[model samples]
Target: MEIDDLTPAETRVWRAFATGTPVDFRATDDEDPSDGGAWGAERTVRAHVLRALLLDGPRAEGEVPALNLAGVRVTGVLELQYATVDHPLRLRHCHFEDVPRLYGARLREVNLSESVLPGLISHAVRVEGVLRLTRARFAGMVRLGGAEVTGSLYLESTRIQAPDTEGPVLQLNQAVLGADLWAPGLVARGEVRLDGARVAGTVNLTDAVLDRPGGTALKAETLAAESDVLLRDAEVLGRLELRGARIPGRLDLSHARLANPGGTALRASSCVIGELWLRQGPMVEGVLNLRRTQVDVLFLEPEVVPAWVQLNDLTYTSLIPHEPAERRLPMLEKGDSYLPFVYEQLTASYRRIGDDDAARSVQLAKQRRYRRTLPWYGRLWGHLQDVTVGYGFRPLRAGGWLLSLLAVGSAAYGLHHPPPLKPAESPDFNPVFYTLDLLLPVISFGQENAFAPEGGYQTLAYVLIITGWILATTVIAGLTRTVSRQ
Candidate 1:
């Protein structure tokens, strides 16, 4: 391109690109035209002119090629679809009249920090270097789906208030990043999706404020991250879903406030996480669902326990803090529905930590919950077992019942002796031996069969026999269950 045909600002940018010199159009560092402040023709560069300099520019000898322009107004859409450019594109603190389209373009690096644009569409683009959009503000959708970044993707302190759309406002689905996704202090007014995205390093979103109520705020289902996904101190007003995710490092949500009342605040169902730390206490206003999820270590010490949870089939190897069964049992009680497997999982977790008493309590609670689903007669039987033996968890209660019944039987029989079954043939009858014979159905002292009781004494004898049989049967059933579990 001839320099004679170029505008003053365009000529300056073209000459600077050949030697990789940055062009700053602002008269002062405080001058920011990003708020729609008009810039004169001397501070404007046509997109076609910039494109020509990027694709067909004449470079100086031994000088690198770069389009580094600042505080300039970019006119028209800078379409670079399927184009291969080796230069770095830096348009910092600039204003764009239209969204730049880089669909399927291959570039070295791109930095649009501190700029204001309607949106950006770089779908399927490949960047060998980092892609930085720090402090940039967008008013429409930012699509980067299927993009592969060799270096990190930075969105630090950026504000994106996207127009209403069917898809997420910031779409990065299926994108693969070589390094971390550093987006601390991000403020997105719409949904941010990372579905199927794979990050080699961590995905940090600390202090972010995502406000897309009645919908998913950050949907990262099946997101595989090598390091941690930190959302510490974030405030997400919608659902923060991570279903089917595989995070080798921790998914820390400490001090975060998630609010999606009457809906799922956090849904991590079917995920396989290394460690999930919800400690230092997060406030979840809705249901926290972890159904079918498997985590190596789960640290759940929320500030306020969720009113409802879905923990069916969730398997965690370890639980943090090792609180007693009383504290943890409340979590199971808040389940959406009765899940026997959840109680068993807690029981096993307590047992692994060498808390036998806690394990027993969890098991007993499981039986009580299970009893609610039975018929009236079955529930009545369950109540008997619970009152007598604590559903087999409190085996010592059986001994107490036996001792009390024996005392009652002995006092009644000692008050009035029965006639001998055969005169002069039966041995001398003893009240203690006679009560023992009547109480133990299988074991006899030959006292009950050798004597005869009439009227009220006969009725007392019948009662003792029936009560003894019930106690014996319950004890045997309870013991069998306990042994099998062991």
Candidate 2:
């Protein structure tokens, strides 16, 4: 298309545009010039007229006046497919009748801020400077697949509508971004994909809203970021998938709200990060799946603890739980009582930090939870043993019980002074030796069978024998439980 193919209004636009001057078409605060209303002296044009003028452009690089179509209503598709241009394009406050197609195009910089468009398709496109879509509105999908941006992608205050629910509103798969994805205040009606995207800087989605029930709102699989990924204060109505992603810096989701009832709210399996902070006022209404995710540090707040957390096989070096906040057990739908591995993961984590005491405490907590799931008879037996011996976990308690039995038996036998039960060269009433002979299994210290107890004293010896059996059984149980865990 040539400039000659343009209409009268378009002719005027071409004259000024081809001469490197801007053309404005906005009315004054009043009615018109007849009603003493003011206006700019620049010529007005329809979207098609300007469309032809843009296509027939200043034939080469460093073309006419930045294509500054500010405040103009474009009545057609701004198709710039497969074109290579070095000039800047600014479409601030413009209203497009259709989506702009920049497929396979190369541009220095482009700005479409404060505009309203159906959407934007720029597959395989490359831009040297920032593509500013701040405060813009997209009524359809914005596809930037395979695009390379030397600078940042600014989507701050932008609203994208994708009513299909399962479809993505923004597609940046495999895109290489040199700078940040600055998207604060973004309202995406569907998913925002970042699969295999390499972001050289932070992905700041602060205060962003993405709603797609039972589906992923953010699919950032294998995303490698040079800096942090912040979702602070954002609200996601579906899943936030970051499977296999690598973030050298922290992944902060502070104050974020996520909900995907009966499904995963966050799945970051195999993700590697410096730190993960899910603290502040964050609320997750579904499973928080972090299976096999490795992080240097993890920080969580009690207020943000979800009832259903899925941290199976998750590994972290240090944990910084906010005051009175413990790792909310893999609060599964049925609770984590049946899943001892969840507690074991936590125990192992504590052990990794050389905190054996904390590890033992976690193990005890696990036992207590499992104890509740047992049958009545099993529970009774478990309680009986736990109270006196910790169900084979508290060896010190067993030792104390054993010592009590020894002391009681020694004192009673000393007072009773039993006679010899069998033939012996020397029959002496040594309470210490007598108690040891009865307590130890299969050991003959000659004080037990050699001594004969009189009527009531025989009852005391039987009591001592039963106590020894109980103590020995408890000691073996404790040792077995401890060794089995290792």
> Which candidate wins on lDDT?
1
Q: What's model 2's lDDT at 65?
A: 50
Q: Measured by TM-score, how close is model 1 to the native structure?
A: 0.93
Q: What is candidate 1's local distance difference test score?
A: 0.91
Model 1 deviation from native, Cα RMSD in Å: 2.3
Q: On residues 42-158, what C-alpha lDDT tens digit does candidate 2 reach at each position?
A: 333455554455555554346445566656556656778987766677777666767788999988788988777888999989998998999888888999989999999999999
Give the C-alpha miss distance for residue 368 in model 2, angstroms. 6.7
Each prediction's whole-model lDDT (CA)? 0.91, 0.77
The digit string of per-residue lDDT tens for model 1 on 81-160 reads 99999999999999999999999999999999999999999999999999999999998999999999999999999999
Q: TM-score of each candidate?
A: 0.93, 0.82
The best candidate by TM-score is 1
